[model samples]
Target: MKIPFYRPYIGDEEIAEVISAIQSNWLSKGPKTVVFESEFAKSVGSEHGVGLNSCTAGLHLAQLALGIGPGDEVITTPYTFVATANTIIHCGAKPVFVDIDPKTCNIDADLIEQAITPRTKAIIPVHYGGYPCEMDRIQEIAQRYGLAIIEDAAHAVYTKYKDQPIGSIGNITCFSFYATKNLTTGEGGMITTADEELANRIRILSLHGMSRNAWTRYAAKGAWYYEVEQAGFKYNMTDIQAALGIIQLRKLEEMQMLRMQVARAYSEALADCEEIILPHDSHEHRHSWHLYPIRLEEDQLTISRNEMIDQLSEAGIGTSVHFIPVPKHPFYQEKGYRMEEYPETEKVFESVLSLPFFPGMTKEEVYYVADTVQSIISKHRR
Candidate 1:
């Protein structure tokens, strides 16, 4: 009866792959990592992929590859994980926050124009909760403004916009392979881009800016001497993580189907509840269904969002909130980001709740979660 918010879908295949990686005795960035990068690029409709230790690392490197640094500004939505904005700061650039669309909870493309300034160098739009942002419009803005598009697609592994994969649309797209993500390598990420030059730069930067990686320099046919190209951070993915990534990538479709099924079950079960506002989906885009977030109509319910979460926990059903709006965080607040400037994000944050969702959840478990949520709402209704 105890249902956790997330559990990685690892199977015998993943175990075997890890074992094979162990047998190779090459745990650092090796053959498996290279193959994972290639296969992942193909899966996302991108020409190249650079594996990294975390999505944050990929985002930081993306900004660096685009020459974004001191005195520059990057526009992004406030209704996302802080990493979206933190990455901009990591590059010694300022993060310009924009409001979100209430419906999709993604960055509102209409509001982007006003945020642009002379110092603007990039626009990092997050595909929030695996829902595709208004990419076409965002692209038009980026093109007209001469800004780079670095998509924060951590929650959007298989999402698509206008029949094009998410990874292929942005100038550079970052994906997460965290334990809770749709596809996982426990703690890893990948950056994809169609530009080969950018890919090469990212590769070099991901592994400490060395001219050659350990795998290459130590190989039989490889040279022992290599130059230090640039001062880059240590953010390389290991062979063990890549092995897990390969198996997870192969099972992605199968896992996605189950995720969709759970999403539908939640939607159908909660459709009749007036106190609940379900997440949006459209025919024009493919959502990865990574997180099934629901909003409470506070007017109809006496309990606050926090109380509702507590009630769910009491019912043995775990839950989470997607985000708290970046501006509301102490770091951003101290940096002069005002919550009032992002009204939509602030409003959404107060009511949004992510239910227990994952590929491993059976139909019965899905319904039980729905029932628990309904019971909590009914008891709290005014």
Candidate 2:
């Protein structure tokens, strides 16, 4: 069978729970969402987890909760999704983009200090491709600069950096449950934090600053009066989405095992292919393997990277690119950034291809993708 780029693994349990939610008539943020939050926090070793509408909301809320605004700068990688930068902009702050480390496609922790200015308030390090970033280095820089750290953990559901889970150590961390991410709530997000004050503020900010939820105010024997203590956004996650998340989170470990196995297979099969540079592991860090991207050696291969993607599709294999440099986007261009500032990001953009990876893929399919890619490269090798 042709392999898909990515697909969510929804079992009958998901269907049953979704129906239960629909029938319960409490389709808004209610018991299920709260339960999902509790379970997720426990699994990821977080003190608290607040469910939201999207990872963008999580990052934006993190900024609001931390009092980051005008005249503040958040340092981040230019190699992540535009949302990472856009969230900082939403807070009326600027995002100072740093170049990514060429090997791991993560923000270069060593270079972050140079970007820190008096105006720099925080650093939002992304766990790219589920690979744990050098958090020790990142946190040390943050501490030295007196800056907060909010992790963009959208791709790192199960990742650990130096034995610490991504959400456990960051000042605040944001995650995505988009269809393409490891865990899908169709469209949802989470904010995990150890700080009690930050967690309380984020919970309020996500629910339109309402002192109490509608379920608390309007449900049986509930009070109707409440106060809006904070001006906030409507970032709450609906029970429907959370219902899916509850089931998805339960299956995460099983899903991750399959993903890692596929990654290992790819690494072993492509070890001798000089035209491709395989993904790397961080020292003493566990990768979540959210993405499997191979960098093509264009000169050694007769076909361009773009052409390889085309050929993969023709051969019944779907592929994608993790990202283009954030600064190269038109919006960022308007803000006066050139590709020359990020050498590694610019070079990697041309060579990278995100192969199909998901829990639903079978071992036979994995081999098929591996063999097909090698065959295609063998035909094109100069």
Candidate 3:
């Protein structure tokens, strides 16, 4: 009964779709990806969705689209996966770190103002573990500062804050269809936006800044005359990857409904547990529940988070930590971000652990995880 911490829910459909793409002979950024981008945009209520090789690429291009570069600072949270902050650095922009809401592990909107300056060109808010951040307040803050917002929605595919989907509300929202994500395309991402000019710029930027994309340029009836306006990376999504995305996107809401069910079960079973603190939903937002992370009541439990992970592993149940504060990572530390600067992230990082979560897990498997967790916590009661 070995339960892996995360698994991609792929079936024959993914395999068959890839086979169909191979048979179609237009594998590179072809019709399938175009259809996927359009369908994904419609589903998320975004005006445009540009598919890319990875969420990092999407974030980078979003910054490039907004004309953000060196000397510009993007305010963001320190509690996230390093990719969120690293993307800003990749764009040659400085990332201004802010502490998080100890509960949701999202950037504290209250503290964003203190970090803003004339150099703050944008704010990148990470929707940690598919839970929506305080977007209204964050948006208001961005408006007051006249700053653009590039959302790190890597963990959020279906999450909504108030009346808007996370992707639709932000100026530029990036989503990862990574192997362990709610919906996956093996490895790919999307950048959603309402800015048509920005969207057109990103579309070109993703395809090597070509005036005409690969599909249009290589088609039999297409003209050979095309020009590169600027240097850009090859970040276009392949048709094979987009084929999988089409299947996943169509099944997204169904999968999300099940994820919520799993979250509710975990919450109900562990809510009253003495040594665990369950995650909380946002004030006016819906969570996609990508990961069900629990906090160890360190004082009440003799075993540390690492020890608990080891215990879960020994019991044939898998688990992981959502993040280890980005600033604490060696790479960020080398870039001048200190652990002491983000107290809330440091506090959350010390005690958090991500439990196994995916749509494929059976009811019995979920119960085994929950029961094993309770037994381990009880065994190590301090």
Candidate 4:
């Protein structure tokens, strides 16, 4: 009866891949990492991929590669994780926050142009909970203004925006392979782009800004000497992570199917419930269902969102919130970001609750969660 929030569907294949990586004795950014980068890029229909230690690293590198620095402004949503904004700060740029579209919980594309200034350099659109932003509108705006698009696709590995994969649309797209993600490599990330020069720059920046071929310098055929092109952080992915990523990438479709099944079950079970608003989905944009965040209609329920979370915990059903909004955080507040500016984000934050959703959740568990939620709502009805 104890259902945890998320349990990664790691199998024997992942373990075997790790073992193989360990046996190969080439652990640091070697052939396996290279292969994983290529395969992941191909899977998402991107021309190039650069593997890194984390999605944050990929985001940071994306900004650096685009020459976004001091005095520059990067427009993004206040509804996303702080990493999306933090990367902009790391590049010595200011993150201009835009409000979210309450329906999709993504940046309101209509509001983006108003936030743009002469200093505006790029747009970082986060596909919140795997539901893609309105890319067509965003793209049109970017093209008109000559602004770069960097997609924060941490929750959108398998997501598609109108038949075009998330990775292939933006100038640069970053994906996360954290433990809780649908496709996990324990802790890893990749950046996908169509520009070969950008890809090479990202690869070089990921590892101390060494020569593009420096990763292979220690190999049997590689030379011992290399030169540093720029001062970059050590953000390279290891062969071990890439080995696991290879198998995980291969199993992505299988895992995504299971996630979709669980999402459908939740929607079907709660379709009649007026006290909650289910996550958004559509035919044109394929949702990856990374986090099944449901919003409580607090006006109809006596219990608050936090109280409901406590109740779920008491019932042994683990739950979480997808995000707390970047502007609401203390760090961002100190930097002059105010919550009052993001009314939509604050409204969504007050009622949103992420349910226990994972690829391998059983029917019994799904029903138990549904029944528990219903029972709680019935007892707390106004």
Best lDDT among the predictions, by candidate number: 4
**Candidate 1 residue lDDT tens string, 231-329:** 988999999999999999999999999999999999999999999999999888899998999999998889999999988888888899999888988
- lDDT (10s digit) by residue, model 4, range 1-382: 3999998898999999999999999888889999999999999999999999999999999999999999999999998888999999999999999999999999999999999999999999999999999999999999999999999999999999989998999999999999998788889999999999999999999999999879888899999999999998899999999999999999999999999999999999999999999999999889999999999999999999999999999999999997989988899999888999999999999999999999999988999999999999999999
Query: TM-score of each candidate?
Result: 0.98, 0.97, 0.97, 0.99
Clashes (backbone N, CA, C under 3 Å), per candidate, total 0, 0, 0, 0
> Whole-model Cα lDDT per candidate?
0.92, 0.90, 0.88, 0.94
Show model 2 residue runs off by greater than 4 Å: none
C-alpha RMSD for every candidate: 0.9, 1.3, 1.3, 0.8
Off by over 4 Å in 3: none
**In candidate 2, what are the lDDT values of residues 215-272, reduced to their tens digit?**
4675677788878888878999989999999999999999998888888888887888
TM-score of 2: 0.97
Q: Which 10-residue span in candidate 1 carries the lowest summed lDDT?
A: 211-220
Cand. 4 Cα-lDDT: 0.94
In model 3, the Cα lDDT at residue 269 comes to 76
